[model samples]
Target chain A: DVKVTQSSRYLVKRTGEKVFLECVQDMDHENMFWYRQDPGLGLRLIYFSYDVKMKEKGDIPEGYSVSREKKERFSLILESASTNQTSMYLCASSPPYLATQYFGPGTRLTVL
Target chain B: SQQGEEDPQALSIQEGENATMNCSYKTSINNLQWYRQNSGRGLVHLILIRSNEREKHSGRLRVTLDTSKKSSSLLITASRAADTASYFCATDSGDDMRFGAGTRLTVKP
Candidate 1:
């Protein structure tokens, strides 16, 4: 079984503060992604990494940045947290050429 | 730029009844997948149907894909209270998988 673990399940931060959400996968998958889930907007991709030191911007990557210094770990960074950025964040990993992705428990972020 | 969009945002059904949800995508896809998420938890993969394949099944879940129409449907048979959750359809275009808004299903006791 593949397992992906997030650094936090719930987090609260003040406005303009910096926030970091970490995700680690044990499967050594080559692909990792970060998404934010909102009520009507659905899960919008923030950023994704295909390999170590490689990153790509998704549909809604303006306020978010990601790091993939190693194969097993991916981190999402918020430059300046705002209330609008508060949403359920999810991380996922998939093996090379595989469409089936394993997800980690989401981190519900609340920016006050 | 969303890839998948699910119809009927919410559905309510009684136990033992079957539930069906539909999803439509914009561009061509390599595969389509169905996933279930319980409230605040992470998503659990249910099934995947490849581009060349038309249908696939696992346990009580059945998935069918129509490449020409760029759409797919998922059916859950004999749904129980435990099956009440948000169902999302994801489209894979080789590089990444994009998900739909999801359909929230409520099972009445």
Candidate 2:
């Protein structure tokens, strides 16, 4: 079984704070994705990385950045957290050519 | 937009009955996958069917894909109360990925 683990399950931060969310996948998948799950809006992609140090913006990448320094680790960074950034964040990984993604447990961030 | 759209946003059924959810997409896809997300959590991959495949099954889940119609359907047989969750269909157009709004299914006990 593949396991994807997130650094935090829940977090709270003040406005304009910098927030970091980390994800690690044991499967060593080549593709990693970050998404924000919101009510009514569903899951919208934030950013995706195909390889180490390579990242691409998804549908909703504003105010968010990502880093892939290693194969098993992916990080999501919020430059300046705002109340609108409060939502459930999900991290997923997939094999090079496969579309089936294995997701982490998710981090619910609350911006005050 | 490449985002898929699921029909019948919400459905409630009694346990032991079958639950069906449908998904339709706008663009050509290489494959379509179904995922289930529990309340306040991440999604779980349920099944995947390629564009060339018609139907596939796993456990009590049945998935059917029709490329001509750009649609897919998922059927859960003998559903249980634990089956209550939001079901999403994601489409893969080569390197791009998009997910639908999802159908919230409630299987009453």
Best by lDDT: 2
Instruction: Please list the residue runs of candidate 2 whose C-alpha ends up more than 4 Å from where it truly belongs after superposition.
Output: none
RMSD of every prediction:
1.0, 1.0
Q: What is the lDDT of residue B100 in candidate 1?
A: 93
Interface RMSD per candidate: 1.0, 1.6
lDDT of 2 at A104: 93
lDDT of 1 by residue, A5-89 (tens): 9999999999999999999999989999998999977788899889999999999999889999999999999999999998999
**Stretch of 10 with least lDDT, candidate 2 chain B:** B1-10
Report the Cα lDDT for candidate 1.
Answer: 0.93
The alpha-carbon lDDT assigned to residue A108 of candidate 1 equals 99
TM-score of 2: 0.97
Error of 1 at B83 (Å): 0.2
Chain B, candidate 1: TM-score: 0.97
Tens-digit lDDT track for model 2 on A1-112? 9999999999999999999999999997999999998877778999999999999999989999999999999999999999999999999999999889999999999999
